[model samples]
Each structure stands twice: as structure tokens, then as C-alpha cells.
Target: MPEGLIVKALSGYYYVQNSEGGQPVQCRGRGIFKNRGESPLVGDRVLFSETENGEGTVEEILPRFSELIRPQIANADLAVLVFSVVRPELNLLLLDKFLVHTEHARMNALLVFTKMDRIPDDEEGESIRRVVEDARALYSSIGYEVILTSAHEGEGMDKLRQALAGHINMLAGQSGVGKSSLVNALVPGLTLATNEISTKLGRGKHTTRHVELIPLAGGGYMADTPGFSQLDFAELGIDEIGSCFREFRERASTCKFRGCTHTHEPHCAVLQAKEQGEISESRYSHYVGFMTEWKETKRRY
Candidate 1:
């Protein structure tokens, strides 16, 4: 059996790109996989056998170190969380939601602020720049790699390329934030379809509808996925929510109780950190929001 990476999965077929690749071999999952409650996902390293017709049968799916839920990719080493400083407006709350998901999935996240050129040269632009700077500072301080980018001027393209080299990255963000444009910039001549932002709605229409890993010229791969605006923590438990926030997790051990929920608990180190200006109030608020949602969900279930 030859081993290859599953670059695309669509309509019950897996496109396996083997080491001796020409075109990807179209493969179908064996019955054993269904019996085992497994389905092939893009970025999965799979073992398969090819027949005379060039179609193949997937024999096994190797272990995955990381997996993303929304885009349904596996073995991705990084998630490039793209956002814009203008147009759609920087939604720190939404960005924090992405960070929580990225952390929970056990993959490194690189924050890419796109559409830098759209910032006006007037006073408002400067104010927006300050806000973006603050956000970059906050996320970087908490140990995330933030890269500033402008698809229009090609700024930060080199840095983006360098960070993506030798790793599989999933490009994700709200629709119209230039996820497609950024992909085109990083991989020239790719010419991915891009849509203009709806001025009335302040949102971009979805361009990339499905997930497919594109091989980078330098090295590694990037999956351009359909942009989405919302994420829910319905799958997460109340007790598990705190671990998603890296800063809170660091100081959780010092709380008064071993299983401290950090909500109205006495001598809670996380709460103390929030009061001492250590944790950003916005992030703490989001944490509490997730906790509240989880609690509500438990009640209904």
C-alpha cells in the first residue's frame, strides 16, 4: 500500500496525493472505516491502494495530532485567523472566539490583520490603527504571533509566506476579510475568486465554499475555507471552558479551590489578575459569556 495525504474530500470521494504524484488518486473509504465511525478528512495521511482505473481504496487513516471542527481538516499545524481593521470592522469579541477554538483544537494560531490599506489617512484612521495596535499587543502578550498584512500593497506577504512554510495552515475568518485575496497574494497566479464587501451589511459574501488544501510554492500547504461569521461553544463543558484561555489557565493553579470555576470564587487568582490589569477585561468577559452559555445549555439538556 502506498501512503499519501488526502488533499480534498468531496461527495464521498477522497483525492489522495501520493508521494509519486501526478494527478491525485480518487479514492473511496473502505467499509471498515465506516464501521469504525471514521471518515477521511483533508490533511489526513492515509494508506491506500490504486487499481488499473486509477481510482483507489483508502485502507487506513493515520493518527492526527490536530483537527479543526468548522473546516473539518486534520493535521494542520497552524490556523491563520485573518481579520480586517476596517470595512467589516475589527470584532475583538469574534477574534477571541476564534482564538478559543484554535487553542481548544491544540494548534498554533497566527493572527493576520488584513486590509491595512483600507484604513483612511485621516484622524479616524489613526484611531483605528491605535485600536489595532492594542489588539496586536494584547494577543501577542498572551503568546500569539500577530502579523500585519495588506493584500492591496503586498505588505507583510513575505512574513506570511515564511510563517506558512513547512506547516499546513488553515486560513479562516469572517467573509470578506480578504481570506481569498490573501491566499492569492501568498500564492501568486492562483487568482482565487474574491467578492467586494456589501457596503450596506458591512460583510463580504462567501467566496470559498469548500475546503481544499493548496500547495505553497515555497513549501507546506494552506487550506482556503469558506469564511464564517459566528462560532458557538455549545460542544464545550462549563468546567472545560477556562482551559481555552491561555492567560487564565496559567494562573488557575493559584485559586483557592482546586476545581475553582473562577466565577465568584474566593481568592481566585484569575479574578485577581483581571482586577490587577493582567487579563484584558474584554477577554474575561468573553470567558464569562462562554461559561454562562455552557451553564444554560446544561440546564436545557
Candidate 2:
């Protein structure tokens, strides 16, 4: 038996990349897997045996440290949450939602702001730049690696590569945020499909419809997943929601009551941090909003 990583899965076939460097072997899960209620996912490490036809059979799936349901990837080390500064405009709330999901999944996250060149070089652009910068600062303060990238101009490409070095990363964000462009820039000669934003709808068509792990030039793999338009915390509890916010979680220890939801609670350390500007007000607002949303969801159910 040989061990390899499953890089792609499509139509009952799994493409397993060899650890010793060769063409990815086409494989199919063993029938036992189906009987056992186990299916191989991309990013899974497995033990396989090659058959005479030059294909392989995935015998067993190794343990996975992390898994994402939407993209259906396993054992990812990082989630590169890509966003744009303009043209499909930046939605901080959506970005935060991605962060919340990433953190909840116990994966490291890198926030990449793409299409920096799209920001005009004028007074208006300056204002927009400031807003982006401030948001970057807020995320950075909470210990996230944030990079400003422009795939067309080659800005921050090196930094982005460095950040992705030696880790299985998934590029996730809204449609038209240039996730494909960024991946192309990071891995040369891989011209992944990219779409222009719709002027009327203010969103981009989904260019990446499926998830596949593309080997990165810098080392490790990047899973380009279909862009998402909406995300809801339907599976997370209200208390779990607050814990996803790093700053809030840290300050939550000081709250007067145990299990503080960090909303409308007197002597709440998280609220105090918001009042003192220790936490981003926008972030806190989102936290509170998610809390309310989760509560309502629980009530309705």
C-alpha cells in the first residue's frame, strides 16, 4: 500500500497525488468505504493500492485535522478569505462571517484584499483606501495575517506566496472578489477562469463552480472553491458565536457573569472594550447581530 494525498474528486474518481512526485493516480474508493459510510474527500491522505490498469483503489482514509462542509475539503491548514477593495465593493460583514466560520472550524485564516489597483488614485480613492486600511488594522490587531494584493499589477504576490507556503489553503470569498485571479498570480501559467462584475447586479458570475486542489508553486496546495454570496450561522450556538470573535473572547473572561453573551450586559468587559475603542465597533455590532440571528433561529426551530 502507498500513501498519497487526494487532490481532486470528481464523478466517482479520486486523483491522488503521489508523495514521491509523479502524475496523480486516478483512484476510486473501495466498496468497503461505501458500506462503512465513508467517502474520500479532496485534501484527504489515504492508503491506496495500484491495480494493473494503472489506476488505484483508496483503501483507507487517514485522520483529518480539519474539514469544511461547503467546499468539502479535508485537513486544510488555512482559509485565505479573499475580498476586493472596489468593483463588487468590500463587504466587511461578509468577510467577518468568513472569519467566524474559519475560526469556528479551528483553521488559520489569511485575509487577502485583492484588486488594490482598482481603487482610484484620487481623493475618493483615498477615502476608500483609508477605510480598507482601518479594517486591515482591526483584523491585524486581532493577530490575523492580512495582505493587500493586486493580481494585475503583481502587488503583494510575493507576500501572498510567503503566507501560503507549506500549508493547504482554501481560497474563499464572494463571487468576483478575484480569488481566481489571485490564485493565477500566485501560481504562474495557471490561467483559471475569471469573470467581470455585472454592472447592474454589482456582483460577478461564479467562475469557479467546483473545488479542486491546485498545487502551489511556492509549496503546498490551494483549493479554489466556488464563491459564496450568503453565509448564515445556522449551525452555531449564540455562545459559540461570541467565542468566534477573538477580541471578544479574550475580554469575555472579565465579564461580570459567567457565559456572557456580550450584549446589553452591565459591566460586560466586551462592551467596555467597545466603548473604549479597544474593539472595532463594527465587529462588535456584527457579533451582536449574529447573536440575535442565532437566537431567533433557535426560537423558530
Candidate 3:
């Protein structure tokens, strides 16, 4: 069977990039996938056949090692969490929430802080600067790769490119945080739409409409999808959420009890670390918030 990767899907068409590397085949998925309630996604490895007509048809979707739900891609090697340090401003709580999902999914996360040139030098920018510095220290300490970049000024572009080299990277972040701009910078001549931030609304309109995996010059591929502001944790469980927080998971073994919720428990290693300033209170607070929300969800069930 001829094998290829579904690089882009649009309007019931799958553009499969074959290993032989000619033009991407505009293929339709086999009808059986619909009956099986499975759809071929960008980044999916597929077995396809050429029809009597010119186009091809996807016959089977091979098994995926990992799948991301938000933008919905299969076999993504890296999750590039892009965020702006200015404009819409940095949201640590949201970043931590994103980290939880990435951790749970077992996807290697690369934190790309964008728009560094937008950071102001005045007194008003003090807090923002502090937040960026702190976040770099905090997340880097937790074993994540952090790259600060300004796509406009070309700052850290080489570092960012080096980090993304030879891997299937999927970009995720809020709109206007420079996901498209970064992609444009990284991949020359490939212009991804980027909108100016609405000064009134403090957010950018969605510029990316669909998911399409673009092959990079550096022996890898990248998918830029619609940026989003919020995520649903409905797929996660209360107990499983603990292990998703890297710091909490690290201290889980030393807790007074197995499966410690880390909320008001005596001799809790996590709580103790939080009090001692080992764990960032900001991160711990969000973890507790997730726990509270999930608890309410469990009650309703």
C-alpha cells in the first residue's frame, strides 16, 4: 500500500504528502472512516490508493502515538506554547493550565514567549518585565525549554528555529500572540495572516481558519491552527490532574498520604513546599482551582 502523511485537510479533502515528495495528493477519505466515527486529521499517517480518476483516496489511518484535542492533530512531536509578554499581556494561570494538558498528554512542550520587543522600558512595564523574567526562571526550573523571541526584530529567531528543528511542531496560543508571525518569520515566503491587537478589546481576531501542516526547510513540519483563549478540562479527572502539574507530581511521593489532594492536608509535601516558597503560589492556586472545579463537577455527577 502507498503511504503518505495528511498534511492538510479542507472541505472534505486531505492533502497527503508522500515520502517520494512530489505534489501533495488531494485525496478524499475512505467512506468507512465516517461509519467508524473516525476522521483523518492533519499529521495523520495514511495508507492511500490512487483512483481511476486523477485524485487519490485515503484507505486507512495508521495508529497515532499522540493526539491533541484543541486544534486536533495526530502524531505531533512538540507543542509550541506561544504567548506574548505584552499586547494581550502574559497570563500565567492560563499558561499553567496549558502546561497541565501538555504534561498529561506526554507531549514535549516548548515555551515560546513572543513580542519581546513590545515590552516597554518605562515604569508601567515593570510588572510585565518582572512577570516575563519570573516565568522564564519558573518554567525553566521545571525542565521546560523556554525561548524568548521577537519575530519583528529577529531576536531569538535562530534559537527558536533550532529548537523546532526536525520535529513536527504544533503552535498553540491566544490570538495576537504572534503564532502566525513567528511561523511567517521561520518559514520565509509563507505569509500567515496576523492582525493588529484591538486596543479596545485587548485581543486579536482569529486569523487562522483551519489546520495545515507546512513543511519546514529544516527537515520538519509545522501546523498552525486557529488560536484560542480558553480550554476545557472535561477530559481530565481530579486525581489525574495532580500528576499533570510537574511540581506537584515531583512531591507526590513524599506526601503524608497516597493521592494527596494537596488541599489542607497535614504533612503534605506540596503544601509545605508552597509555604516555603519552593512552589510558586500562583501555580498552586490554579491547581487548587482546578481541583475545586473538578470536585463540583464530580458532585453534580
Candidate 4:
């Protein structure tokens, strides 16, 4: 059997990119997969056999290093948390949510702050830059790389590319954060639909309805997905929430309780860190928000 990477799956068809590097071979999974309750996902390395009609059937899925259950993408190495600095403004709360998901997925995250050119050269611009710097410092302190880029002027794109190169990167952010624009800047002429009706797909601008991996110039492959705003902690437990925040995880060991929720616990290291300015208040707030949601969601079940 020949091995390949599943780059895209649409309407029950899996487009497997040949391992040797050529046009993707359209393939379908065997009926046994359904019987076994297993399905192929984009970014899955698969063993498949070519059919007489040039299509193929996946025989087996190779073991994945990491899999994101929410988006259903497998083996992604990094999540490029795309956001904008000016227009819609940067949402620290939302960025923290993405970070938690990326952390849970066991993948590195890169913060790409887009739309630098759109920032007005005035007092307001200074304020925006201040927030951006703050976010960059906060996330970088937790070991995430932050890159500021102006898609209009192509500034900082090289750095973005360098971070993505040779890695399975996933572009994840809310709509209107310039994810498409940044992808366009990185790969010219391959324009992605930016929330507009796409004639080619005959669908609305969410052409990436299903996650699709676009081949990059270098060895890297990027999974282009629909921009979504919300990530409910449906798959996460209340105890698992604290570990999602990197800073919280670091301080949790010294917490008074072995399995501290970090909420009103006596001698909690995480709370102490927040009071002592060791942890970002914004991140801690998000953690509380998630815990609340998780508690409510957990009770409903």
C-alpha cells in the first residue's frame, strides 16, 4: 500500500496528497472504517490503495502525534493564532481561549497579530500598540512566539513564514481577524475567500467549511479552517481546565491542594501569583470564565 497525507475531506471524499509529492489523489475510506467507528481526518497520514478509476481507498491511519477533537484536525504541530491589532481590535480574552485549546491539543501556538498598517498614526495608535505589546509579552512569557505583521505592506510576513516553515501549522482565529489576508500575503495568487460569496465553490465565503490543508512553498503544510469565535469546553473536564493555562499549570504544583481548581483555595499558588503580579490578570479571568462555563455545562449533563 502507498502512504499519503489526507489534505482535504469534502462530502465524503478524502484528497490524499501522495507522499512522493504530486497532485492529491482523491480517495474514500473503506467501509471497515465506519464499522470500526474510525474516520480519516485532514492531516492524517494514511495507507491507501489506488483504485482502477484513479481514486483510492484508505486502508489504515498512521498513529498521530496530536489530534484536536474540536476542529477534528490531526497531527498539526502549531496553531497560528491569527488576530488583528486595529480593526476589530485584538481580543485578549479570545486569544486566551485559543491558547487553551492549542495547549489542550498538545501543539505549539504562534500569535500573529495582523493589520499593523491599518493602525492610525495618532494617540489611539499608541494605545493599540501598547495593548499589542502587552499581549505579546504575556503570551511570549508563557513560551508562545508572537509576530506582528502588516498584510498590506507585507511586513513581518517573513518571520511568520519562518515560524510556519517545516511544520504542520493551523490558522485559527475569529472572522475579521485577517487570517485570509495573512494567508494571501504568505502565499500569493492563491486568494482565499474572506467572508464573501465564492463563485467557484458555489457557497458562501466559508469555503473552508471542512478543514483543508494547503501545500506551502516549503515542506510545511497549513490547515485552512473556517474562522470560529467560540470554543465551548464541551470535551474538557473542570479539573483539566487549569492545566490548559500554561502559567496556571506551572504554579499549580505548589498550590495547597494536589488537584486545586485555583478558585478561592487556601494557599493557592496561582492566586498568589496573580496577587503578586506574576500571572496575567487577563489570563486568570479567562480561566475563571472557562471554569464557570465548564461547571454549568458539566451540570447539564
Candidate 5:
């Protein structure tokens, strides 16, 4: 028996990298896994039996520290949410959803603003500054790190790499925000397919179809995922959603109610901040919208 980490899953095959064995072992789970109703996911650490055929059967799946439903991976160090400044514009609703989802998984969220070169600084600097500042104050206030990146003119690649240098990060964003391009830049010859953003639709074609971990040059690895338009938030209840907004949490604690939903609560600290312009109205609006959507969506189930 040996222990290994499930690094990749493809074509009904699981690739496990065994440290003790010093090699990747292609393996499948035994009937015990099926009987116990356990299926392995990428980034999962497991115990297995090494077979003579250079493969093995997974016997046990170690408890996952965190799990993300969108990419369906476990034990991620962080999630990089990439979005473009122009082209498709920023989707606040989707961005909030991703943030909440990442927090629910107990993974740190890194906001990456990509395609900055496309939106020239001369034309979009002030606007971009406001957006970056608002995002920084909004997310950073919630304990997340927000980074600016540009794959076109290579603006923030070094900073982005520095952030991901020692962490196992998962890259996500709306399709065509250059998630793949960033990955290509980070890994160089890895060359993940990148597509042109459609002028008519203002979105990029899906270049990555499935999640794959690419090992970085110095250390660490990154998981590349397909572009997504919507994410599931019904699993995250409204009461626990506030802490996900780092900026709002401190002010939120001052709300009149112990479990204030920040909507319609008397003397709500969160709403007070919104009115005082301490928190961006745009972000607060998105929070309310997310709660409303979640409530409606949950009622059906």
C-alpha cells in the first residue's frame, strides 16, 4: 500500500503521483470505493495499492481541506478570478457569485483584472483605477488579494506569478478574459490555446474544455478551467454570505441584528456604509441581488 495525490483525471483514467514511489501511477479505484459511494477528484490525496503493471487501485480518499464545485477540484490553495476591463465589461453579479463560491470552499480568492492593454490607460485609466480601487477595497476588505494582469502587453504577469509562486491556484473567469493566455505566459511553452475575443459578441470562445494542472517553472502548479457564464450559489445560505465580502464584514458586525442580512434590517451597519459611500453601492447592490436570486432559486428546490 502507498499514498499519492490524484493530479489529473482524463478519459476515465486517474493519474496519481506517488511521492514514495517517485513516479505517476495510472490507477482506478477498487470496488470498496464504489461500495462506500466515494469517487476521487483531482487534487485529492489518497492511499492506494501498487500493482505490478505500473498502475494501482485507489483504496482511500483522504479528507479534502477544500472543494470547489465549479472546477470540481479539491484542496486548492486559491482561486484566481480573471475578468477583462473592457470588451465584455465586468460582470458584477457573476464576479460576486464566484467569490462566494470560492469562500464556501474555504479557498482564498485572488481577483485578476486581465486584458488591461486592450483598454488603453489613456482612455480607461481613471475608470480602471476606480474599478481597481473599488475592487481592492471591496474584496481586500473581505481578506482576499486582488491583482491586475494584462496578457496582451504583459503588464502584471510578474506580480501575478509572484502571488502564485508557491500556491496551487485554480484559474477561472468568464470565457475569453485570457485565462488561458495567462496560463501560457506563466508556463511559457505549455501553450494553452487562446482565442480572439469576438467583436460582435464581446466574449472569447471557450479555449479550455476541462480542468488540467500545469506545473510551473519555479514551483507550484495551476489548474486551468473552461469559461463559465454562471456559478451555483444556492448552496451558500444568505446568513453566512456576508463574511465573504471582506470589506463589509467589519462594518457588518455593527449591524443591529446578530445575524443581519444587511437588507431591510434597522440601523444595519452594512446599509449604513452603503449610504455613507463607505462601501461601493455597486457591490452592495450585487450582494442584495445575489441574496435575492439565491432565495428565489432555493425555493424551487
Candidate 6:
């Protein structure tokens, strides 16, 4: 019996790193897990029993600060949302969903726009850069950081490295968006599997089927997560939605009502921002869509 941390869990095996570990000790939980409704997840600190033969058994799971249902990781510091500017194209809707989920999980959201090399022409590249800058501003206004990247060309690699320097980052995005490629670029020699975008669908094939945390060269962990077509917003309530969109908070406070949904609410500052060309229409639309769906789901539940 010894103390350790669960670094990775897959199939039915858990990799536990002991307090005096030379290497991570692989262990399986006792059958008690099934009865107690407990499943060990990554980032979980646990007590384990070590056999003389170098095997181990998970004895108990420690408390967690937060848990993400999709990737099923615990105590994540940040969520890196990766997307390409062209190929599959950027889905602002999905981006918002990831940001909301990150906030709900109590983790910071970092936007990483990949594949900048594809943006042709000095003029065209500048245009694309402007779009990214605008997006950066939009998220930054709401207290999130956004960075541009090209896993192939190595653009912004330094900044990306610095940004991910100390945090436990979970890399999340749709399939074929180069999440794995970015990981390989960040920590050379860690060639995680990567797939090309489908020509027929103009999208990426979902390659990463599970989540695994890779230690960076400097000093941090980057989680390579599975890709998905959609996220379940029903898990979040209407009240929890507004705070995720940080830009809205400042103006939302000025709304006439105490608890403004910002949809059909009289004298809403968010609407005014859209009218005044202050907030990007795309983000406002995302907020409205999410707010509407959350309210509907709440009613149904």
C-alpha cells in the first residue's frame, strides 16, 4: 500500500505515479470501484497498494477541484481550442461551446488558430490575421487569451510554448483540425497520431479516440483529447451561461432588469453593443443561441 497520482486511465488499467516513483506504476482498481460508482480519471491523486512484484492496486481516489465529462479529466488548468482558418473552416458556434464548457469546468480557455501557412497572399494573410486579431480582442475583452499558430510553419510557436509553459492544458477541437500535429510541434519527438482532412467532406477524420496527457519539454502537461461533432449544452443552466461570455457581464449589469436573459429583454446593453458595432455580431449570435437553448433545456428538465 502506497500513495500515488493517477496520470492516465484507459481500457481497464490506471497508470499511477508513486510518491517515490522511478517510473509510473500501472495499476487496476479493486472491484470496489463498481459498487461505489467511482472511476479513476487523469489528474486524480489516489492511494494505492504496491505489490513486491512492482504491480499496484488503486485503494482510494482523492477529492477533485473540477471534472470534465467529455474528456473526463480532473483539475485541468486550461482548455486549448484548436481550429484551422481554412480547410474545415472555423466554427464560431463550436468555439463558443468549448469556451463555455471550459468556464463551466473552472478552467481557462485558450484559443489556438492553426494552419496559418495556408493563408495566401500578403494581403490575404493580413486579412486572415485581422480576423484572428478581432477574435483575440473578442475573447480578451471577456478575459480569455487567444493565440495564432501553424504547426507546419512554426509560426507563434514560441508564444504558444510560453502560454502553455506552466498549465495543464487540454487540447480540444473538431477532428482533422491538427490537434495532434500541434502537440507534436510543441514537443518535438512526441509524434502522436495525426490525420488529414477528408477531401469529400472538407473536414478532418476523427483520429484521437482517447485523452492522454503528454509532458512538455519545458515543464507542463498537454492533454490530447478526442474530437467530437457536437457538445451537450443541456448540462449548463441559463444562469451559468451569461458569466461564460465575459464581454457581456460589463454591459449586462446596465440592463434594466436584474437578471437579464438579453433575449427580448427591454433595454439590454448587449443588444445595444451589437447595434453600435462594439461587440462582434458572430459572438453575440452565439450568446443568443446558447442562452435560448439553455433556457429551453431548463424548461424541459
* CA error at residue 44 for candidate 1, angstroms: 0.8
Regions of candidate 2 where Cα sits further than 4 Å from its true position: none
lDDT of 1 by residue, 1-301 (tens): 8999999888899999997778899999999988888888999999999989879999999999877778899999899999999988898989988888888888889999999999999999999999999999999999999999998899899998999999999999999889999998888789899999998998889998678989998899999887886787777776668988999999998999988888899999999999999999999998988888777877888
Clashing pairs in 1: none
TM-score (all chains, Cα) for each model: 0.96, 0.97, 0.96, 0.94, 0.90, 0.91
| Root-mean-square deviation of every model | 1.3, 1.1, 1.4, 3.6, 2.3, 2.2
Residue-level lDDT of model 5, residues 20-50, one tens digit each, is 6476888887777778877788888888887
Give me the overall lDDT of model 2. Answer: 0.90
Candidate 3, 133-196: lDDT as tens digits: 9999999998899999999999999998888888899899988888999999999999888899
How much is 68 displaced in model 4, in angstroms?
A: 1.6
Candidate 5's C-alpha runs over 4 A off are 20-23, 121-142
Residue lDDT tens for model 2, 42-160: 99999999999999999889999988898799999999999999987778988889889998999989999988999998999999999999988989999998999999999999898
Off by over 4 Å in 6: 19-21, 122-127, 295-301
Name the weakest run of 10 consecutive residues (lDDT summed) in model 3: 292-301
Output the better candidate (1/6) by TM-score.
1
Between 4 and 6, whose lDDT is larger? 4
Among all windows of ten consecutive residues in candidate 5, which has the lowest summed lDDT? 116-125
lDDT of 6 by residue, 54-143 (tens): 878998988888788898888778889998887877667889888888878878888899888888788967887787677777777767
After superposition of all CA atoms, the RMSD between model 6 and the true structure is: 2.2
Give the alpha-carbon lDDT of every model: 0.90, 0.90, 0.90, 0.85, 0.80, 0.82
Better of 5 and 6 by TM-score: 6
Alpha carbon lDDT at 7, candidate 4: 94
Q: Backbone clashes in each candidate structure, one number apiece?
A: 0, 0, 0, 0, 4, 1
